[model samples]
Structure formats: C-alpha cells, structure tokens
Target: MTKKTVPVKPHRRSTPSPTPRPNPNKPKPGPKTVPVKPHRRKPPK
Candidate 1:
C-alpha cells in the first residue's frame, strides 16, 4: 500500500465583528431618579 499526504488548509477571517447589544435579561446598574421613595418617611408617635 502507498502512503498519501494530506494538504494543509490556510485560516482566514472574513470581516470585523459588529458591537454587541446590551443584554435585556440583566438589570441595569444605577439608582432610579423617581421621587416615590417608600422608606423616606417614619410613622407618627
């Protein structure tokens, strides 16, 4: 039987990848600007 050699293939990148969008499942980092605080006032004696 004769031995055969396989040819090596070259690696190539097509184009630059686009920027990824923010994930919707993850919560955003920052305090809310709403003026509806619940723990701001205390009960009267």
Candidate 2:
C-alpha cells in the first residue's frame, strides 16, 4: 500500500504542488530557496 500510495499521492499533490511544497520546506530552509532541492534531493521514503 505504501508503494502504491506514493504515486497516488501526487495526484492530489498535483494541484497544490507549489502550495504544500513550500509550506513544509519553508521551515526546513525558508521559501527563499530555489524550491527544487528538497524534492529532488530528499532521500526519504
């Protein structure tokens, strides 16, 4: 279910792509960043 979920997640995630991305990453590094690193460089499952 977890594996199947990651892709399904991006569906709802599609609309709020930029919304939630920075919301969480905001504290991680601030919204001043390029906003590509966290998504691309993240190693979490």
Candidate 3:
C-alpha cells in the first residue's frame, strides 16, 4: 500500500480494484462481502 510518497498514490484515478482483486492481501474479509455471499465468481481465496 506504500507507493513512493505520491507517485503510486491512488489519486482520483480509479478505485475499481476492490471487487475483481478479491483483496486477500488484507488478511481480513473486507466489508460485509464475506457474509453476504453475493460473489459467485471468485469465491474468495
């Protein structure tokens, strides 16, 4: 999550990585998506 002070900073570019990536790197199930079970695609790690 560290990106060269401001180089790799997310900026206003885009935050469209929450769903596709599955965000397993966070070690915790982000938000309520884990219990909701709306994603029949990736199915967690």
Candidate 4:
C-alpha cells in the first residue's frame, strides 16, 4: 500500500483602512439647552 501527502495553504493578513477627517470649513451646530425642574422642599416636622 502507498500513502499520499497533502500540501498546506498559506495564511493571509488584512490591513485596516485609514479614517476620514472632518472638514474645518464647515460651520458647527449651536448648543442645545434643557429646562431644569423645580426644586421641592420637605415640610417641617
């Protein structure tokens, strides 16, 4: 009886793409303000 040998495949490595940068010429949005709730006081014992 004769034995057959199998060949091994090479592994591949992937590189990540660069991130996009924001444009400085564009105007920024205004800040938003939230309403504050009224403070409650405890009754005197």
Which candidate's TM-score is highest?
A: 4
lDDT of 4 by residue, 1-45 (tens): 787686865566455556654876776755744445556545579
Per-residue alpha-carbon lDDT of model 1 for 1-45, expressed as tens digits? 887897866578655667655786777666865576678866688
Point out the worst 10-residue segment of candidate 2 by lDDT. Answer: 5-14
Clashing pairs in 4: none
The lDDT values for all models are 0.70, 0.56, 0.62, 0.60
Off by over 4 Å in 2: 1-27, 35-45
Writing each residue's lDDT as its tens digit, candidate 2 over 1-45 gives 354544434444445344456455455755777656765786868
Q: Candidate 1 at residue 15, lDDT?
A: 57
lDDT of 4 at 28: 70
Evaluate model 4: give its lDDT. 0.60
Steric clash pairs (candidate 2): none
Q: What is the lDDT ranking, best to worst?
A: 1, 3, 4, 2
TM-score, predicted candidate 1 vs. hidden true structure = 0.18
* Regions of candidate 1 where Cα sits further than 4 Å from its true position: 1-20, 31-45
Q: How much is 43 displaced in model 3, in angstroms?
A: 44
RMSD (Cα, Å) for all candidates, in order, is 12.6, 16.2, 16.1, 11.8
The digit string of per-residue lDDT tens for model 3 on 1-45 reads: 775565565659665655666565767655866554566667667
- When summed lDDT is taken over every stretch of 10 residues in candidate 4, the lowest stretch is 32-41
